[model samples]
Target: MESIINTKILVVMTILALSTGLGSCKIVQFIFGDSLSDVGNNKYLSKSLANANLPWYGIDFGNGMPNGRFTNGRTVADIIGDKMGLPRPPAFLDPSLTEDIILENGVNYASGGGGILNDTGNLFIQKFSLDKQIELFQGTQELIRSKIGAKAAEKFFNGSNYVVALGSNDFINNYLLPVYRDSWTYTDSSFVAYLMDTLGGQLKLLYNLGARQVTVFGLGPMGCIPLQRVLSTTGDCQEKTNNLALSFNRAGQKLVNDLSKSLKNSSIKFGDAYEVVAGVINDPAKFGFNNSDSPCCSFGQIRPALTCIPASTLCEDRSKYVFWDEYHPSDKANEMIANEIIRKLGFLYVNGTNTPPPAPAPTHAHAHAPSPGS
Candidate 1:
């Protein structure tokens, strides 16, 4: 009971902090999505290809040990949290994560290989799809309600921020794979429409769960990733795949704007990761990257390792390479992407309101931080 009071106190204090301009108060995040945003959720899955528990995965994380993040260091989500003075959300499946921790520091449910469609990652054997993620969040919502009653729980949940970075697997792992039924089920345009329809319902579910401030990241250049490039005979980006991503981003951007208005008091912003990361990929030197096509970690002669094995070739300077593996970016590239997205979204601020002074008013997400518990 005492622990519950402390939990409630923490929630109230955070709400008061945001409402009263207490800069020191911790901003918690409820994170979702896939490997890009996954901290360590996949590691907990028993039989999963969504694993990133091996060495060198988190070399730059804390003390040079893998912390379950797919990248070499922080993800785009991690860097964005740092910029906003928000705490790093622990993996939802972390044994150490309790109800107290959930309400306080928040939790990340993002899983590698997970996608909008449930069957998207069937090859992985185990993964939490977006629908599964929402179901898990409902459990978290229940825990919060138990701790501080329904009203206070609503206040806390509504005040907290949310981040969702997903949908990549729906293309590469699902629609593109001949083994999957979705490939033959829908054409390119129809597939994206199916994805958007699923994603739209997912976002609506989140809003129903008190997700007032959400950032839905747009897909980047899929054709330029090390995995996709290796498949190209000319060793160049596949423009056709890129155009498909643009189709999704176009419809996705519309969804963000539409949801922003429909979900009363909600601020659903679309992070323009497509343009930001493409800038780095197109002109690598401009962003301090020399080799954007090749991955920092390799499996020797193989274009893209399913996941880096123990015997994979490691690059001398991970920072110089744009990609860490076939699918994900290196720590340096993630930082570049995160910083640019932050600039566009504009959550960081010096004053109590936490608004970006230099950035243009974000046309997508809410420009001003919504009042806590408003």
Candidate 2:
């Protein structure tokens, strides 16, 4: 009777351990990028032009609060988190939150106006450079280890998903602007190559810091932005700008592919957001987008100097528009882009290992949940 009782206790302990290990397998998502992925980091910067603290920003979020997200609703990162069965990562600057927030899913280090280069621009002077974001990601990983354990943390990151969306500001706001265009004396090709080198170094840095799976988004068509259109002749997309974006995308693709080969055991996937976005612009109706060239907000004879605001005439239906403003995509557009990213991630995440279980359905209600797009 004593031996049997001891065996039962051992069985209970084993079951507890197994349950703990299984629960620890929660997948963490680390997002790094610019305005496209920024949740609320821009709000931390006082007097920063990158601020998104306004109503129009989160009109579809139901909260009716901006949250410093530069969109009519959730961005691609939010969709990725939803698809991964994790909550949208809280901003690193949210003082109300604790490390537990990060351990549950992950942390978002993305900030609007952030770029690969430290000396990028003036909009958000205090924004985290790509290198700094990666460091924060490392810190988050350490926190996860403390909360869970080293082995669990390792497993979490080993099978984790990393999404990086950036590079538009580097070209549109920094390199191409007259202030630096003459000062830097860099042609489009040289600028792209420089960006590629720096970004590749950053990817390698993340890899060394335990990022085994990474998805890098290439540059989108910046020429078609309302800001660019207003600045160009004929009020159309500047061919030169589009060419630069394409060049950057091509180079970025090569960089990600080469990095995968160099890293050997690591899996790095490149999402062709450039091509996908360009497709929507080139063929809008096919993707359920109505206006692809012009922004849905602040339309008409407004000059590039004007900003999209409440006073501006917003489109009646944001879902039909690809771009919400000058530099950001609408929620509908972001959902499409996010879906494409997930498809690519599926290939990378399930490449050599057993497929991860499908993410459970979301518990909380989202105002503008992601819908299927081409």
Candidate 3:
């Protein structure tokens, strides 16, 4: 009788533990955005103006093979996917990927120099804009429906998390570009309003497509980048560019909050990238970084006038630097940002109450480890 009672007690404990401990259950992540989130889509596009599949780009990655990632190693997308128990999805443009694989695992449609508007990244003629990425996502939805039936596809869409980390290029590559100078036509506030309107509509379209959990990342401090700093006469961060980024982040935050309330079943959070990155930049030492202003792999006196090239000087300790090139963050910087963002994401997904678990956890099925009682 006692043996049977103990057996029953053990079973009950196991059930309780499993229910509470299986935290990172969601595995599929549908990522969309610009170069910050891009893995390798630009590699397949010959006409892409922002190519990174070259020396000094992936110098820190395994075997130093440039895998089309803009940074010296993994991007924030790759790190976040790791923490979420998700396998890094292949770029949609990867010719070797099959339809079956894409349906089973989500596809990454982010492109280098991509933006919210079709004309935003026009300098990169081959870049896929937000509208184009969404259209491709719709195609992905249909493919899933055709293969697994409508009900199954709907379930998958609802279960998966949608991530959008775009809009930076809309300002940097379009509004600020001398050739385009879209900002010249309107005040900063007006430009921000226009971007918000378009972005809100695109987000609504995504909700209509069945994304119950969506995370939208706001713009970082673009003015602090080496490229922007080099352009300033005083060699300091341009106040105008900084203001534009701030305006965009503020608008994005409000948009995400409004969408979360209106969508009813959806949970959307605006990743305050400006705040997170600003903190790191203000005190690089706190984040184990020695230099925040200079590029780790670019030429010139901290403020390089060109992109990282094959002959560019490389930093001995990549972790000591914050920026990898004139435009992007170092792999270590990305790792720090990814860790902080994942914690924020964990809190968002867990009903906004608890602190998130630590990083470097196992991936995929291993994340769903058995409970102690079991």
Candidate 4:
């Protein structure tokens, strides 16, 4: 484990070395995954039970308005967009926007409760799986082609970065939930292997769809969160859940390494989110946080059994709390995590050292054709 951690640090250092000094490049972003990246995709789904389009969900947003993001404010995708000097990409499901406007900048296809596997978030009732998000992105490809022609669309997508952050729900909502728990049939290691394998194919699909720059966020310490703490009589971190999360994160690192090598003309960065959040959890004060184990928007009590709801008490100062609700991080915490990710992914080709070579110009064999008149 120490060796792997060291290797990950080395990889980050190498990327930092390569990405230093580059002034700017035209890098658009298309985010995928679950609630962690969902700007408002779940809000547009009629049957979606996993939605944050309610009070306190976006209390810290620009105007204190809930926009269906799971956090109290901007998500990691939104933060990255800010860092990249771009506005938060619109949700692909937003009916208020036109296809042309949605494709003007990349669109976010993330949905709360989404996972790498189709069956992972069945409890959500309606949520796009990673496969479905990719399919939606494929649809955007058609719109882009229609607007700018196929060749220009190819250049557009190749320059764009795809941010994917899912899989926590696969464990928290599926493997750990009583109704869908897989522990009876599969061990922790086996379950993580299943997730990694499924994700590998999904990543390949993005590559096929012209995504050459991608970032995958590793899972954090699930056992330390409030919801899991409430389940334990002792109210301490659940070691089993922590171990499972660590196992998945380690394997995810390996998956990123393998994909980086296999996919030519691509830049794949594994965001060490586990490390970042674990640091904040271990010493909340270090990150200017007062609470790490409890949710800030719980039902009046510090350790309330019920999580944030419409009537739940809100924190006086959300910035001091690491967690906003039971399962999601606060806006402040998301900002910290985003900063950590940007530190690693921020300068993605600073001096052209180890920079990914430009993707080959698109042809009929490159980007798949859109439907009739698409």
The candidate scoring highest on TM-score is: 1
Model 2 vs. true fold: TM: 0.84
* lDDT by candidate, in order shown: 0.81, 0.74, 0.77, 0.77
**What TM-score would candidate 4 get against the native?**
0.83
Winner on TM-score between 1 and 3 is 1
Per-residue error at 127 for model 2, in Å? 1.5
TM-score of each: 0.87, 0.84, 0.84, 0.83
lDDT per residue as tens, model 1, 262-360: 899999999877887888898999988788888876779965686765567677667778898899998788888888888888876322466422321
For candidate 2, list the clashing residue pairs, or say none. Answer: none
Which candidate, 3 or 4, would have the higher TM-score against the true structure? 3
Question: After superposing candidate 3, which stretches have Cα over 4 Å from the reference?
Answer: 1-26, 301-305, 347-374
For model 3, residues 100-157, the per-residue Cα lDDT tens digits are: 6665457899999999988888888789899999999999888777766787678778
Error of 2 at 317 (Å): 0.9
Query: Over 4 Å off in model 2, which ranges?
Result: 1-23, 84-86, 181-183, 299-301, 305-307, 344-374
Clashes of 4: 4
lDDT by residue (57-124, candidate 2, tens digit) is: 66666455567888777887777666655556678877765666665556788888888877675545
